[model samples]
Target: MNNHIPILVEMQKLDDVIAEKLVLTESLPKRLSGLKKDVEDADNQVSETKTRLEENRKDQKLKELEIKSNNDQITKYKNQLLAAQSNKEYKALNSEVAHLESQNSLIDDVILQLMEDESSIKAQLEEELKIQANAKAELKANEDSLNLEIKEVEKEIKKFRDQRNNLAKDLPRALVKRYAALIKNRNRKAVVFNNGNKCGGCGYVLRPQVMIELQKGDEIINCENCGRMLVFHE
Candidate 1:
């Protein structure tokens, strides 16, 4: 049995585990950021709704003031009519009062429409506020758990790397260096199995002589195409 082959196999296994943990560690931060974004989007929706509601309410107040001002003008015109010195002046005062009344009627219709809009907006705002509150609570509840999970994954990755280093110490220094370089350059695959005369790493067809050498497993055999160590698994 080739000692380096078995050690390389073990190292490959450790690398596989490290690869999985690295992917998870990388994704955890993105997941946490997604959650944060959800919360932020919900908050923005609530804020926008509140702003619209405030503007609508302010418009409603302005409309009400305008109606009050119209009524005051109508009242002043009626008092002037009572002291009118000519028929023309009296008729003019009456026309002015009628116009003010018609204007007030139009403003009243607008106010009614605004009130309906306000009601709908208030309902929508209430719903958005609830959504925002729930999103905040969910983010707060999961934040610590997500951080802890990422830390645990980091620890596992560190442990696997340390184990790999320890395993490398038992192999020849040159062999370990070759393995490390292959793993770095070959997508983290230093040793690959020969699959039916095919190079498992690069899927290149293997020569009969190369397959024979891999089957003996007496020494490290490199795949001709990928330069990865080829091991025959009985």
Candidate 2:
């Protein structure tokens, strides 16, 4: 049996864990970005709703001013009706007052309609504000949870790295260097035990002589086809 096989296997296990940690770390940014996008979308919707409400308020104010102006005109025509001296003048003044009254009625109707629309818009704006507030709170809570999880993963990564470095010290200098090089090239999995005459990592068939040498396990043996460090266990 190869004396170093156990340590090499330990190293491989650590390497697998490191690979998983690195993948998980890399995926966090994408997840966070997705969350940020959702938050931004909600905020944008709220902003648009606020803008619409402001426009409705301005429209309502303009209609109110128009109604006030029409009321002022109605008062001015009423005074002129009281001051009319002749029948012809009285009739003309009456006609003018009637026209002003018609305009006032139209302005009043427009103001009423605008007031109703303003109330509806205000209600909608209030509902949207509530929704936005809820969404913001939920997003903040989710971000806090994700941050805690990332911290835990970072702690695990540190532990794995320390354990891997400590394990490397127990390996021979040459073997350690070779394993490090393989890990750099192959994403940390340097050695795998073969099943019979087949390489496990790449499933390449091993020669009988190579298989026998692997069983003795005195020295590190690499698969000729895949260049992965090979081990044999009976």
Candidate 3:
């Protein structure tokens, strides 16, 4: 049974290797997910800003048309006043010209406001475009880097699995089966340290008898609370 201690230690080392590989595998998707969200948010902001800029330009066009129509009316009313025979008709034509001028002035003011708004929006959109361009480049670079990293991690995981299979070949069927099952059910963390009297995996107080057995290091023992394989600490 004492000779079995070496085998138990080797098994724990294998478990550590597997756990580390699993951690590396889990990180890839999370990193990609977060970066993807950032890129998407930046793109949406750029699109919204561009839309506002375009709408301001359209409003400016409408104001221009309104001003032009008011100018035409003012010119027609002036001609009518010049040709008028009666005092009343002349006064009416003059009032019409004044009204058209007032309307044209208001439209001019509106056009100015629209032009200012358009200028501000264009500037904002330009900034946003620059930000989006930089973000797009960063996202592309990050994705490329992550793809390479993922490939390397997959290769390493494959290598570790191959090694694990080779190691399992020399172990007893019962022990291998137990280890595999625990790894599958326990977040890939099949092995845990025994911290003096406590099980590091579950914080459970190790039974005195179990602690003695662990000291013997003869056989694999599980933490009853968490069902994780325990390795005695140095």
Candidate 4:
């Protein structure tokens, strides 16, 4: 067996761990982003609810002013009816008063509806605030844990990478470069075994001569299809 084969296999083991931990460092942030999104959504809901409540109160205030103006006009019209000079004038004044009262009735109904909406909005705002609080709390907890995990994963990768590099010192420079290239290009796998008639890395069918050479273990061998170092395993 070529001395490089065993060293390559050992390096592959270290690289495997480094690669897997690197993936964790990436995915942990994505998980944190999702948690942040939940808090963001809750904040939006709370803001919207508060805005609705403010608008509802403003609308209620405007309607109250309108009712007050209508009442004042009704009192003035009543006074005019008392001093009316003819039946037609009194009838007209009375009709004006009735119309104003009808408007006031409709306005009252609208004010009541606005109050109900205000109540509902206040309740919704309370619930949304609670949700916002909970989301922030949950995010904080997970964020701390995920950030710690990311740091730990980074440390692990660095440790394994250093080990892998030190191990590579035992091999020739050209072989190490070739292995590194394969690892970078082949999804962090540089050494693979035969799986029946196929290459374990790419599932490329191995030729009979290729199988015989791998079984002999006389020298370093690569798969024709994938160019990965192949080892024989029963």
Candidate 5:
């Protein structure tokens, strides 16, 4: 009802938009971090798969070297069997050869299994690489746009805040101070519309006399419960 109410209402509108933009400013970086974390997670998956593949390859190499060494020892044993002078010596050499051949067979099976594991690891590596690529692309796609939106939101909030501050200059200092305190402490709602006989901000019951005074628009009337400046609404 006070003359300053209209100006205060206008300032509230600006402040509402500033508040909205400010929220966007806060959320944008969090969203960017989330997006970046996706890329990091995918990259880690790829790296882990590659490390497994590398380990598989190294194990295969070491196993192959073991087989080669066993084969060399078998050849030496065969030559010794040819030169053996006694029956016992020849039989011992023959036994050694057979044992070595059996060992080679087991080693071959191990090598085959290693090869199979290598194949599986390589396949997994390829899939992980693809996932990593897709995650990076997705981050690149969204990052720039989100950053731009964040900047734009910041600029808009600053602009709206400037307008609201300028408007405040035209109002009485004591009233502006009161409104600012309410806005800071009451979820940015220094002024609220009436919902029937209740305060819109806190649902506090408003008496008939207060409602009548609000309708009369003679002066500012704060809600008894919430202390917010009330605007009469249908």
Candidate 6:
């Protein structure tokens, strides 16, 4: 029974490694998801900026057409002023030309403002596009690295599992069954060291007789309260 303690300790070491590997496996996908989201957000910013620039260009075109139409109206009004038969008609034609010129002046100011805004927006869009490209490249590299790491971790877990199985084969069948049952019912810790006179698994105080048996290491001694295999390491 005392000889079996070393095998159980070895099994516990393998179980600890398996548990850590499992946690790492679960975290890899979450890391990949986070990187994907970063790239998506950068792409969205670039798309929205391009849409705004296109709309601004359309508005500038419309303003230029309006200015051209106003100029044509002014030319026609000047021709009517020359053919006027009365002073009143002449004044009316001149006023119409003035009104059209005034409207065109305002339109010109608006066009200039639109041009400035377009220039600024174009620069911003170029910068955003560059950032988006970099983000995509970074995501791809990280994804490849993470995939490789996941494979390595899986291989290590397999190795540890094989080692534990081989060790279990050396122990008696009944003892293995008992150890398995304890692991299932006791938080995966089938064997524990005594902490002074207390059970290390459940912190239960051992009776004087149980403590004496554990110290001798002659037979398997379970904690009376928690039923976990107790080992006394000198």
The C-alpha lDDT values of all candidates are 0.91, 0.82, 0.80, 0.92, 0.89, 0.89
Using lDDT, rank the candidates from best to worst.
4, 1, 6, 5, 2, 3
State which candidate, 5 or 6, has the greater TM-score: 5
Which candidate do you rate higher for lDDT, 4 or 5?
4
RMSD of each: 1.5, 3.7, 2.4, 1.5, 1.5, 3.5
lDDT of 6 by residue, 76-185 (tens): 98988889999999999999999989999999899999999999999999988888888898888899999889999999999998998899999999999998898778
Error of 3 at 231 (Å): 3.7
- Give lDDT for model 4: 0.92
Sequence-dependent TM-score of model 5: 0.94
Summarize candidate 1's per-residue lDDT along 71-189 as a digit string, tens digits. 99999999999899999999999999999999999999999999999999999988998888888888899899999999999999999999999999999899989999998899988
> TM-score for each prediction?
0.94, 0.74, 0.86, 0.94, 0.94, 0.76
Supply candidate 6's per-residue lDDT for 103.
93
What's model 2's lDDT at 3?
73
Please provide the root mean square deviation of candidate 1 (C-alpha atoms, Å): 1.5
- Looking at model 4, report the run of 10 residues with the lowest lDDT sum: 1-10
Tens-digit lDDT track for model 2 on 185-210?
86566898897779887888999999
User: For candidate 3, lDDT tens digit of each residue in 135-164?
Assistant: 777778898888788788888878777777
lDDT score, candidate 5, position 23: 84
Provide the lDDT at 157 for model 4: 91
Write out the backbone clash pairs for model 5: 1-217
Q: lDDT of candidate 6?
A: 0.89
The 10 consecutive residues of candidate 3 with the worst lDDT sum are 1-10
lDDT of 5 at 121: 86
Best candidate per lDDT, number?
4
